[model samples]
Target: MASELIPNAFLASPRSVRSSLVSRLLAAALLTIGAIAPALAGELLPLADKAVVLAFGDSLTSGIGGSGENYPQRLATLIGHEVINAGVPGETTAQGRERLSTVLRDSRPGLLILCLGVNDFLRGVPEAQIAANLGAMLDLAADASVPVLLLAVPAPGASQIDPLFARLARLGQVRIDLHAMADTLMQPALKAGLVHPNAEGYRQIAKAVAQSLRDGGALISR
Candidate 1:
């Protein structure tokens, strides 16, 4: 059975919202009612050891609407370690694949948290190609013996990418369906269409990631 957990509501500081517009009332509600999933695995890695968490993705990972409330930074505190934010605004899976080598070379993180593909959606890129890019990235990580956590993208509001995510999951990638958690991330305050997450959004993503890591046998409990 799927686990059920939600985060308490809190006001998110205003930040730039790019893209589609959301209703103010709705955005407000989302920020106030955001929920989080349960932590999946329990201490896959020793708590005393430091983990290099690489946050790879587009502007959403860049903290687009959240100033400093990016998921990776919030995750650092949650996981108690240094998280390297490797997200670039307007980057697609293809660009991410092209730059993977440099990111890996520099970060060499023990744990990699990949959140991408939003740009691809914006550009109407084929889902198959997007999946291919993701697969290539995962393959590279596998070759390096680095554990990977793949965050699934939202289904473009009425468009779902579960099939793509499932394909990646079948290949042994630890997957978290951020799409399914969108309700928790969406509120009255999030009228902007761009792929930014508010504080509640970050909390939901972080919680889902933490849970997936725990369940996938990738992390250790405190």
Candidate 2:
């Protein structure tokens, strides 16, 4: 683990994210819909029958700690579609940006579940470069006309999506799930390690994504 903690300035839900519910409640009460609430749900992903979902990210997406049952695998069962796990351990945003084009071409997916960028945080990459890499990936997906559902990957010890992720949703014109991993990583029972989640945690993340798909008007079977 990196000795230096990520400066709180970059944190979206800087707290344990367990407190986000209360924070949002207060925001609502104060009539201020700030970045804390971010874009949890927005435009729906255009999913087709037998839609192929390619989940792209890092070790978390690959089921490193989940004993082979990762979130994408659980999500495939949840949504009744062919979900491809396209995760690589220790991948940074720049690497993901470069690899995404090939994955998008090969997968030819109808929907993309992107849970990336946290690795860049761990490596202390400049925030601007990370944001640029993520933007480029979103552009790639958009160019393919593949709808995306981005899950904001939080930093270790933090529960909510990074603030930059919120901006990406707007720029990419994509729907985002800000709570799934944030909520999952914060719970000790849900974690397999300090950051990665176990099978059950992955299950909950799948459930959350499935719910978002449903809410976004995808006709998911269970």
Candidate 3:
């Protein structure tokens, strides 16, 4: 019985050693990925002075309630690039997804600023549909080799930030957290209406976006 137990222990030791080695390798790989992810996530193509950035969204992008100074226009001024406002008032994510290809064809922009889904949130659209529509739009941009900057729009009265947009940002390799600027602009003093920002608010948003682009290494020196 003692001899049989000794062989069993010997047999088990190799397996245990192999398992530990595999675990160590996996941990090292995970650490490597963790260290590199931030830089990779923030990487972007260098923009030319005249590069076009397509600001595609709904009413907020259209300067509704703004002092004739929408975020796109403000961003154009801040970045010194051509930011084409492709926003349509009262548009939903599904509508934007459907219309995006045509706009891409027409604009041929180097970058895309996606800020839709507010109308969908207002209309009680499901989060899944919203994500799916946005994903399709990202896929379209990917096909065109256009880098995207994702702006998260929160639902009214929500207690916590939505995770879907951040998840999509990682998957799409685009900038996230632009929603924080939107939230800042949503303050009563800055907001012209319940949903849209005023001129000063738009300027602030543009500044935040420009800084984000610069930090992400996306903006080229003019």
TM-scores for all candidates: the values are: 0.72, 0.80, 0.78
Per-residue lDDT tens digits for candidate 2, residues 4-92, read 01111212223343233223322333332246434433445347777799999999899888987798889888888899999999899
Candidate 3 accuracy as TM-score: 0.78
User: In candidate 1, what are the lDDT values of residues 1-222, reduced to their tens digit?
Assistant: 122212111112122331111222223323322333333332233333666878888877777776467777877777677888888999998999999878888888887777787788879987667767786776566556566666767646544444455445433334445542354335536423445666667766666666655554555555
Best of the candidates, lDDT: 2
In the predicted model 3, the residue pairs found to clash are none
Candidate 3 lDDT by residue in tens digits, 1-222: 000000112122333332332233323333323221221333556787678999899887888877688888888878889999998999998999899999999999988888887788889987667777787787677667677777777665454445666555544445665344456445678777667778887777777777777765667574
Give each model's whole-structure lDDT: 0.60, 0.72, 0.68
Total clashing pairs for each candidate: 34, 0, 0
Q: Which stretches in model 2 have alpha-carbon errors above 4 Å?
A: 1-34, 40-42, 220-222
Worst lDDT run of 10 residues, candidate 1, spans 4-13
Question: Order of candidates by TM-score, top first?
Answer: 2, 3, 1
> CA RMSD for every model?
13.5, 11.0, 15.4
Lowest summed lDDT across 10 adjacent residues in model 3 is found at 1-10
